[model samples]
Target: MSGGSKLWGGRFQKPTHELVDQLNASLPFDRRLARHDILGSLAHVTMLARQGIVPLEDARAIAQGLRVILQEIQEERFVFRLADEDIHLSVERRLRELIGPAAGRLHTARSRNDQVALDFRLWMREAILEVGEGIVETSQALLDLANEHRDVVLPGYTHLQRAQPLLLAHHLHAYVAMLARDLARLQELYRRVNRSPLGSGALAGVPYPIDRAFVAELLAMDGILENSIDAVSARDFALEFLADLAIVMAHLSRLAEELVLWSSSEFGFIEFDDAFATGSSIMPQKKNPDVAELLRGKSGRVFGHLMGLLTVVKGLPLAYNKDLQEDKEGVFDALDTVALLLRVLPPMLRTLRIDRGRMHTAAEQGFTLATDVADALVRAGVPFRDAHEAVGRLVAYCIAEGKTFGELAADELVRFHPRLAEIVFPRTVWDAVRAREHPGGTGPEHVARALEASRSELERTARWLQQERQRIDEAFARLLSEEFP
Candidate 1:
């Protein structure tokens, strides 16, 4: 047995079994955090030098070595080994190669526990912003589609049955609204994820004269994680991220479901572009909406990750356990899945052809105007429940007579209730949709205003993304440059 691969093997007399090494190694997946690990180490060493815990020359050496490792990783030249266990060790091992023993002093005031926590938080901060940007782009795509088809009418459903007429824009806006909440969740969680977890050494505060606030500021984080124990052990930020991603996936899945249904011959409300659709291996006539189906199907994987992390953390005693190693793969995978979903869905929606005539015709065929007719009855001085019942009977009579609401004459309508004759029913799908003029309604004007509001909201979110990204970029650039306090 050999202990050469283990960084913390100083006290152990013999190395663990090879199977244990393979079981415990995280470098395979966690190499994704290599850049973040280097960034965190840079901040830590800079702070250590500034606080006089380590000499400025040694700090410069470590910083220079880390920058080299970062460049190698960025250029695809950095070698990662499973024996190094995880990103922290992989980078440290490489840092040793580049700068010798000065790399050893780099870990002076921090534990791998706090170090890993800080690295994950830093990575998640960038990820939340990236996911937010993806949300913005996706929202923009939906808005563009809405703006283009603001007047196109479709049947809105309740319990998978047509219930009312809605603008296509209004329908697309529903997803934009859902994604807005998803973006808001990421923004809110960003605050929690942005706090620094460095200086909380191994679940306890370090005794050295380290400046946690300086380190946090250097990394452009919001603040330190105040509680040392929580700083190292808390995986709540990851959990929140996964939960938010699951919601985003749910929204995408719903939209994907509609796309699937609409593209089907039974609905024929939309058609996917050839680029977005896949053909059956044996059935040449079939052009499948595989992207949409995938969007719907992959949601479960993200949901499972959220639940998996919840279960992983549910039984753990706080303050950093080996079990916490289970956190990154799920988070990394969920983020990738969500990012891919956001990336593909917008284009899938944008390129697809909508059958406006088909949607309007379908909208007209369903008794979507039943509610409007009921409301008209109430306006004509009928009591609400009586009006509902009267409309119910009218629908039944139409169904029995092989008639539609529009096919019934005034006398025929009056047979249900004399007052119904006094109220003119909405004559067309547009009339049914335009009847809803209130704020947030399906009316054209309301949807137009909603699109404008979404555009403005998108602009605000875009500005925020730019500012936040710039702040982090500048802070990181300064950390690498020759300028030092």
Candidate 2:
């Protein structure tokens, strides 16, 4: 159908070509939002009848028809037609088919502009909650892994070279920190997405006595949007959501990359469980970290989705535009990508094997205790810069002699710095790993303290997630009672 000769056909004479209809249709992707569109229509129709814009009987029939359609959709029995351009048009056309003229009254005071705005906001509000829950689940998995491996020593790296020794729990908790920030961002996005934009018809307030706040409450929204133009034009929630997804994906990609590297024979710091790995076709010994690699690869796709939506919305003159139709695909893709990662990553992480012996051996070989040695010199009254330079020369001499810094004999240490004494050198590798006792240092005591702090953070995050989920569930229940009961 032509844009004008379709459902809203009032000003045009010609029919749209089949090719044009297929090209412009969003029903293929946006059908996922069908339930939200129907819910919004039900609320709008009820508000219309209460305002005397539509008869009460018509509103009742329209609501019944919508309820039937929702059931069919939930059961996967509803047929989606390409003739309808998007979910809004598809559901309205179906309503008309079911309830005849009563369906016509359902759109009396609403425009597709504000109607779509409301539908998208409602969908995103729910999606943000789901994404937040998924993040929390993944965070819990990381915390569990951290708790299991709190004492496993690993080499921490800077510039891809060993910098110090650290507990594996500390490394895993870094991701938990990133995910915590992601959760906070999603919560803030929920605050913005919770506003209702139902009364902003097209680009202006509708000429009806409908109560916007009543519809907002029926939808369980935090508030009604204030400005008609801003309401219809606002897509900041979508952008914010995509941006947060991009950031979380970046963190995931970093973790994935490390997993890939650590699983290599050169590192041998970790091994993937058979379920999360794949064997090469020709190489019998090749069990690959394909899951981690795929996770890393998918990060680019999510980022591309974010940039695609950003490009689509960057310069559009608002109310709504044909260009905005491009918005759903990217948002849906980004949501799918994040949801899939959230579901898959925790299982993969939980199953992976940590080669703690290899990690410890690597940590021991890198002279990761050089910083502790430098600090020891500092404590012995040497200025920090002087100690650092002295350590640097000692490290160079050790490398030239094919030795670790720990191999320097107490008497041999005097060759590099004559002020050194026989009691200066650490007697054991583990002693070297534990010598720097400063707070937040990688010393044994500090690592234990860090582990405790991480455990406390994990508990706090779990409590927050539980409370947030309960709050959302209560809001959804209130919406159900107000709108459906």
Best by lDDT: 1
Instruction: Score residue 312 of candidate 1 by CA lDDT.
Output: 93
* Residues 105-222, model 2: lDDT tens digits: 8888888888888989988877787787788778878878887887788888999999877778768878877888898888888888889988988887889898999988777787
Whole-model lDDT values for every prediction: 0.88, 0.81
List of clashing residue pairs for candidate 1: none
Error of 1 at 409 (Å): 3.3
All candidates' TM-scores?
0.97, 0.93
What is the Å distance of residue 405 in model 1 from its true position?
A: 2.8
lDDT of 2 at 283: 96
Candidate 1, residue 456: the lDDT equals 98
Model 2's alpha-carbon lDDT is 0.81
